[model samples]
Target: MTNLYRAGDLRTPDALAKVTPEQAGWTYSGMEVFDLAAAESVTRVLDGIEGVLVPLSATDVTVTVDGDRHRLRGRVGVFDAVSDWIYLPLGSTVEISGASGEVALCSSRAEVRHEVAVVAAEDVPVEVRGSGRATRQVTNIATPSSFEGADKINVCEVITPGGNVSSWPPHRHDGIGDCEPVNEEIYYFRMGQDDSSHGHPNGLGMFRVYTVDGSSDETCPIFDGDVYLIPEGYHGPSIALPEYPMYFLNVLAGPLPERTMAFCDDPAHHRIREEWTDEDQDPRLPMTSAESRVS
Candidate 1:
């Protein structure tokens, strides 16, 4: 068996983005999906790691961390908008209930333990990243600028509309060159309904990963609930089909003393950044407005 894993190649449970540390040959990062019906839930306590519970297709959930409780709400399917999340420190037991949909649990193995904190849906910063077809909505939920109190995790959400691209210009956080910090990343993807006349599959997209030295390269087909692991590479230009929207959750961690997402663009394609300087960012940005939620 090769080191790379594909969608169907990795057998998993109802929860997706399933990858083991041994399978990745890495120790600091882990990603998984957790789903429960209304009033149904599960409890977990990872002794040496901090975790982030991100709701994918959800509206409400009650999270109890070591007996402290926080209620989360305002979550919808991937195509709709951003949602709420909960973070738990190491060695702490977590009980999640009233979860109405699927939630992604992205954990990082760490020794530092912080208190439990809840990030509400409204507080999440939504920005339009890239321009033109490369345009997409970014919900900065757990990045350094968004949340703290975690030892080794930096998470963000990206939504690439159909016929557009995100992760463009091919960048990498694998090494320190260009002052970029090295980090391993995992991408969990979801696609909206396909409205093509050809009767295409719903929830499908494209992803490319390659080493700068040309040591290896891969561009694979991805679908809803599929996962791609980036141990080291310049990964980019994740493109959705012509008629649907693509959503992906990014989880990153590394050996650096402080957690930060730093990456260098491929020299060959870096000039494109300059070309888009004068262009307007896509008009479809800020995908969700305050109107979606009523007081």
Candidate 2:
């Protein structure tokens, strides 16, 4: 029944973190985070799943799908810039190798196969959302509008500056309202300290998830490398601490016939959207971009 997993709690010998739909008690959506050593390699076969290979902290990574090689010019860290990624189709053999640092394999169950393609960091869409303290940077890696190859999986990265909040107004995509799309979501967090691009273990943040009827409610502190699963609920307000910036990678999937990120906001706080019109967005936003990663 626990939804939050701390760093190292899900570690395996080959991966720093790993989660599968079966392990999460859901039908779709899964992810694995691996810390690779120089010249080392890992291989996986996507039997009935489609996935995206995202480099977390290295620019020299290489991904090979069914014999086709893709060199990814990734960033130094999630806070440093947007990363190059690869889309993997169902029933293909994937091999990840080359330089070091962390890489995330985000996946979802799929029935239809899509073509494999490499997406450069510059090609990813960057959007600054909200206003004032509610501001955050959203890097759309594989959202429905941004990418059309996938049948189920959806992935994105969010960066919240120090003392700010992201994922506000608490929304739900569990088909609770008319036309709401249902999806299982996973949040993989990374917290920054001082001037470091690589996240720190001691850095902290907060997150909350609850039902509208008050049947279930949970709020807790979040740390670097932590993972939170949302099977069903209105979730939001990922708060970054005063001195520690926050970053989270989101992977989502579900049984819906069409892939979508549509959601219904919590009515009580929905009015906050109107308030953002008069407020100025924090200047620290657009924290990371493809141009910023260049040395």
Candidate 3:
């Protein structure tokens, strides 16, 4: 019944973390984080799922999908820069091999099969959201607006600089209010030590999630590799401790006839958006970009 999962609680020999819809008691979203050694490879059969392969810390990654191979120019860490990603359609065979570091396989169940597509880091859209302390960088790797190749899967990464917050106003995509889309979402987190260039496992952050009826409320400290599931609720204010930047990969999916990221903000805090108009965006914004990853 808990929404938060610590890194230590979900470790396997080859994976740093793994979650399936069946495991989370949800219907749409799932993900696995692989920690690969040099020359190591991992294979999986996508029975009824579509997925995006994103490198968390591994730059020398090669993904072979249904006999076609694609190499990714991945960044050193999530905070370092945008990463190249590959999309695998449903009902295919996938093999991922790379030098030492981590990679994430973010997936969603799909009824329709789509074509395989490879996205370079430069092609990924980077956006800055919010203002002042709420400002954060969003790496749109496989969102609905960013990529049209997937049938149901939606993926993105967020970088909340040190001493700031992201995912504000506590929004929910549970199809309530005027919100038309309902989605199950997963947050896979990593923390950076002092700045964007230094990602450390020991860095710390915080996260909060709750329901409107006050049924479930959680505010907990987050560390590298922590995972949070948002089946249905208002979630927000992913807080990065002072001097420790926070990064998270978001994987989302739902049963809607079409894919969308529409969400309804909690009415109580909806007025916060107006306040941001008077504040200037943090200068530290746009923490990472494709050009920064260039070797």
Candidate 4:
């Protein structure tokens, strides 16, 4: 295994400032690619644009500023099938997308490995409307007992398996807490098949992002290979219509004095929380054994 720790140390202000998207050859799509040095600087620029990084192949990029390091990785392509890991120094902001393989984000000193499986739970919190889809949670690190003293990152995957995860009453993350400030997040989507072995995969799911002043409705159109980012504001309960079971990969980072999520519920259906019931796990879940590889 290659030790990628050195790549993380080179993303200083001066080095990053000297690079540009053009010189780095960061194309929207193509065989065009960058090595570790160029990839690091390119990630900085992408970070500035909140860049939507498309993976040309399974790739890795690491950036370190001063003593802090941040690393980003792409899913290893199906054929090569090699697991990749990047290390970020403590406090470096890192975002990862297009990862079908296992991943991790941690303080540089922490010995976190790629297969560690950082997601918190299999069955997550969900709120549903009468006819819409369900907001099933895949991972969460903020449970009561886990909230030791300081808040950790909040990462979850929302599945619209049958187009039922969206279109309820829209919701946001503002004022959800008193002890810690709100965090920023990313949404990565995995589009469902047109014809599931079970059913169809199409229904217009809506997501809106907004602030107290106003909101942007239907800003994110759900589709395969697209990623929507939440720098701040209300996101949604994605509703999958009759077709389209949308799966969302969510990543959140915030500064919380304590490790708990106090979300600002959507007032429209906040009352629904009172009547919710925990459904038994769908036997179809865990889709297949984790060790099983796609042939």
Off by over 4 Å in 3: 176-178, 196-198, 293-295
Task: In model 3, state the lDDT of residue 47.
Answer: 92
Clashing pairs in 3: none
TM-score of 3: 0.96
Tens-place lDDT digits, model 1, residues 84-164: 788888889988776467777888888788888887777888888777777788888788888888999888888776778
List TM-scores for all candidates, in order: 0.90, 0.97, 0.96, 0.49
The lowest-lDDT stretch of 10 consecutive residues in candidate 3 is: 286-295
The whole-model C-alpha lDDT of candidate 2 against the native structure comes to 0.90
Q: Which candidate's TM-score is highest?
A: 2
Provide backbone clash counts, one per model: 3, 0, 0, 17
Q: Which stretches of candidate 1 lie over 4 Å from their true place?
A: 1-14, 176-180, 194-201, 289-295
Q: Which predicted model would earn the best lDDT? A: 2
Candidate 1 clashing pairs, residues 3+ apart or interchain = 133-164, 133-165, 167-237
Q: Write the per-residue lDDT of candidate 3 for residues 126-181, one digit (tens) a residue.
A: 99999999999988999989998889899999999899999898999987656777
| Each model's Cα RMSD | 3.5, 1.6, 1.8, 11.6
> Candidates 1 and 2: which is better by lDDT?
2
So what's the TM-score on candidate 1?
Answer: 0.90
